[model samples]
Target chain A: MDVSDILAAHEAKQKAIVVEKDIPLEVDAGFLTVTDLNPIDVESYNEDLEDYLLNTARDGVQTLIASLFQLPVTPSEDGPVAKLPAPTTLLPRAKPLPKPKPLTKWEQFAKTKGISHSKKDKKVWDEEKQDWVDRWGWKGANKATEVQWLTEVPKNADVDFDPSAQARKARKERMAKNEKQYQQNLARAQQAAGSASSSTPNATSNVQRKRELDKTLATTRISTASMGKFDKKLDGEKKLRGVKRKFEPAEVSSSTEKSHNLAILSKLDREPSAKKAKSGGDDVLNVRKAVRFASKGKGSAALARQSGGGKGKKGKR
Target chain B: MSTFRAFILTTTVILAMLRTIKPKNARSKRALEAREPKEVEDPRTVIFVKGTHAGEKVDHAMKELMALKRPHAISFSKKNTVRPFEDATSLEFWSQKNDASMFVLGQSTKKRPDGMTFVRMYDSRVLDMCEVGVEGWKSMQEFKTAKATPGHKPLLHFASDLFDTHPRLQQLKSLLLDFFNGEIIDSICLKGIEYVISITAGPLPDSPSTSSELPKVHIRAYTTRFLSSGTRVPRVELTPMGPSIDLTLRRHQDPDPELLKQALRRPKLKKQDIEKGLGNKKKMRNLEVDEMGDLRGRVHLAKQDLGKLQTRKMKGLKTSRDDADESDESDEDEGQVRRKRRKV
Candidate 1:
């Protein structure tokens, strides 16, 4: 080999032997390597040996002298400490561990959906949880804080946390939102009303006229079957209205006959006639009187006519 | 001697008249007719089964009622002459059988004109209308902060003394309240072996203005409470017991399986379909009847055959087939195996 190549190889050997002084890396392998090699502080030993010595020179001579006084070396009771071999210049370098990924803005926003980002800057209240949360980024600003929104709701900020009151606040906010929407709708309706009033003068009157004309047109198309029935009904009604509203003379005559019979019965109970008693001896008289009374609607005139041709039957006494 | 005899006779007549006028009118006659046919709501009925009209004991009446056959209805000439006092067994039986919602039985020393001691029963609801006793405890607020401190000992002591005065009576009242679902109860009245209890099941509270809502009931419970002192306590006022009804009750409150199933059926379905369903149920009942008829036929035949076969050992003739078959059926039903089957 050339002199320059030999010099480069020796420099590489010197660099490999040097180690950083921090928590140990590659602890699984049988080695004890340390940086800032103050030879007095750290001791390196072969793995096969039972005994080991710690280098106390780098820590200062006070530590060395204290150790030389031979203070009792009490090993740890947990597990045996193994002796590690000294690091050589030819040892390979240890690999580094992989780094963790960073969170995106969407993920950060999701976490704050139902929680307060910070307690110090309490502005907008988390309506769902009824607690204060960050307003964060609103109103054309980047990263507006909870402290700003908090000024908007002073009454809420001042009150202590009460579950029932919080629920009321949420309800009030919801109602306010609805009322705002309703007011907007009312304004729109009022605008429309103003525009319509200015534009149209007789829109409703025209609509009414159209409806009346349509009704007249509909009435002209009646079914023939229904029209015939309607005509017959009207004729029957007129006849009913024209009829005479009085009782018949036949009915009056029957009532008079009933009254006359009642009067005769009353007279029979009061006084018996001598002529009638004498007539009782005849069988023909009984049969003839029975036939006269038994006839339907038997009136005195009809009986009189049947007995003696509309004249008095008996001779005058 | 005539004057002395006359004086004695006059004295005797006056004594007899006084005895006849003894406080019989005070005892009211029990209306038995009111309790029958249609179930009465707490008709105070005093049933006097047996025992002498004079000096009739409540125990004797209770015994007679217990011994009387099931469904024995008797009418007495002296309706208010005999009475039963606090008879639990008869009270329970009458409550169950007669559907008497409330009952109270007590002995009254008041005798009738005929010198007969009588017992009286009253409608328990009368207590709700009329004040009975005093208030026991008012509200829980008094005991809310009653920690076991030196000052609290005196209050506890007072309570202990009150409990000690009537331990058994209080226990009995507690037991009765438990027996009848925990009703907002009033005092327990004991008028000569008569115990009248009044209970008002308080209304449940109204629910919030949420979609899932509950009913609201008016709390008009006029309840009285008795003190530890046996004497009637006073100063306990109450609200009106109100009408004994729930107006805003849901119709068909519970879905009766049979009724609900019938209601769910097609409205277009004819009455004949319903009749068919009922007829099927009746036919199932008739199948059991047929089985019984077969058993009776077998029993009759066995009895006839047994009589004919028994010749030498027919002196006693006690092995009746009717009795044997009945006993066999009973034993089999009771899970007792039969040894052998007699062919007869």
Candidate 2:
């Protein structure tokens, strides 16, 4: 039997499966991507860029498919599915890196003094309780003096001196001072960021600063007991321009507005929170309904008096 | 009198909404502050506004776009009495109130019928705006098919050289990219990619390109299917998902150079990244990230003579006592032969 014809056919079949290229394709199976870094044949590319691009894309996809077929697979509902590993490509963060927080007053001082920081834990060991508890808060270590039953008094101390009350007053003052400093630091940091970011548009940033300052001033002015309406007008204190409120015209014929209102009503009707509030809670029985049923529509007052009388009778028994 | 009363009835519900802008209480203040800019930014919220004379087509197109943009979208179904081209103060007001940075305004005036403007805001001010006229559209509702989950990041495919070459088309491409840009993710799962939006341009005229208007832009959405093709590798196919639209470029505005520069600014790279050869022009020697993103390195050593290297001791290969002297002589002769040939 002649095997030459069979050998030629086998050779042609092998050639169809094999891929020949100068540079090997880099297959990232995790990402399902294949990158071919081989230099382009400039003559063919210059002839027709679109056709060249298409051929290159086809080659890449073909390589990717070949690599994918070699991967280990598990039987899935749809068929055998090759599970893709987590992608290894490093993507740049979409937003800009966060700016470091501006140093607090104490932090700045410590820096100048070349002092290293050591963090203080929020919880501290209490010797009396023999357990860890909050350093400050309800029944905290800081308020130990205020809650103590007994206290040592100085020989020269006045009779009216209440040590517990005095300790509480001191703690409140410290808290208020810390809050004031925190607000100051926040304002300073915002100003720095605003100026730093808007360096190119110096004039616009300045305008923004002026506007922010005016807003703060207005808020502070109206924050008084009189709401700034009855306050004495200071010299050259320009009037604060408030946001104007404009309503739609009375004779408006637009169907859009009507439809919009209807939409809002429908949305509210569908709201779970509003429904829950109206029904108090679906999980619990309605007290009003229970009272009406128990008293045969006598109302909650009758139920309340009956419950109180029942409690009194139980105590006596 | 009845019409006047009707206006009051309509205004009351929206009046409650308007009151929410200033943050009357602590809870409102907290809610408003949640929209503040973060270090890693959240996806931008978008507001859709309807013009006084918006047509049915314009409204439906906006509605379908809104469907894709939900969870971060706010809709104003009312007819807004504002022209963006003339006065952008109204848009600014809406942006500030909602803390939204993007807007899709649909209007159909007699002068510019079937128009849709995309207004983008930066720092609560109008940065750049562009308007496109709607030629025709097919809403998502019409297509009864499996749809992509709302707010999923979509793969955008631009199918024309004009998108890269033509200025107007380039701007349109940029606008569309920004509009569809969702959460930033480093890696995506194969199955997670549910849909892709393909944008193609109409044919350009052969002559007098400058005088003629730019070609129409066709936007089509498709769902991807990975069919098992007898092998481990699956065959991919695209099925049509709807909300297909055709747009022609209209009035456009370029962003300010200074503002654009500020917007494009990138943070400084970390020292570790630079050492890994991820810098512009200062790559470290003998380092590379492999295809799997693993760091690969090369090492160098001083050259050595292979003949002088030690080998495992063996009874048969070891030289005898008398052969050792002969072997040393032969080694010297072999070394001298090379030098002798050089002298010759």
DockQ of each: 0.00, 0.04
lDDT string for model 2 (A1-317, tens) is 99998888766654543456786765555544344555555576558743554455444545555565565666655455665543333222223345577998889999999999999899999988999989998778899999999998879999899999999999999999999999998898887777788758778877998999988988877677656766778899987566333466777566977888899999866646654677665436666677789877878776677776655344221
- Docking band of candidate 1: incorrect
lDDT by residue (B1-344, candidate 1, tens digit) is 99789768865764554343233443422343333332112212333333233233333323332222112222233333223322233333333343332322223234321121221112211111000111121221232332211111000000111111333322322222222212111111111111111221112223465432322111111222222222111112122221111111111112234533432232232344333332223322222223233311222233456646746655276566566677787755443232333322
After superposing candidate 1 on the true structure, give the runs of residues whose Cα lies further than 4 Å from its correct spot: A1-317, B1-79, B82-101, B106-182, B185-344
Give residue B266's error in model 2 in angstroms: 1.9
- DockQ, computed on Cα atoms, for candidate 2: 0.04
- Best of the candidates, TM-score: 2
In terms of lDDT, the poorest run of 10 residues in model 1 chain A is: A89-98
- Chain A TM-score from candidate 1: 0.14
* Candidate 2 Cα misplacement greater than 4 A, ranges: A1-100, A109-134, A150-166, A176-317, B1-33, B207-211, B229-233, B273-344
Q: What is the interface RMSD of each candidate, in Å?
A: 46.8, 7.7
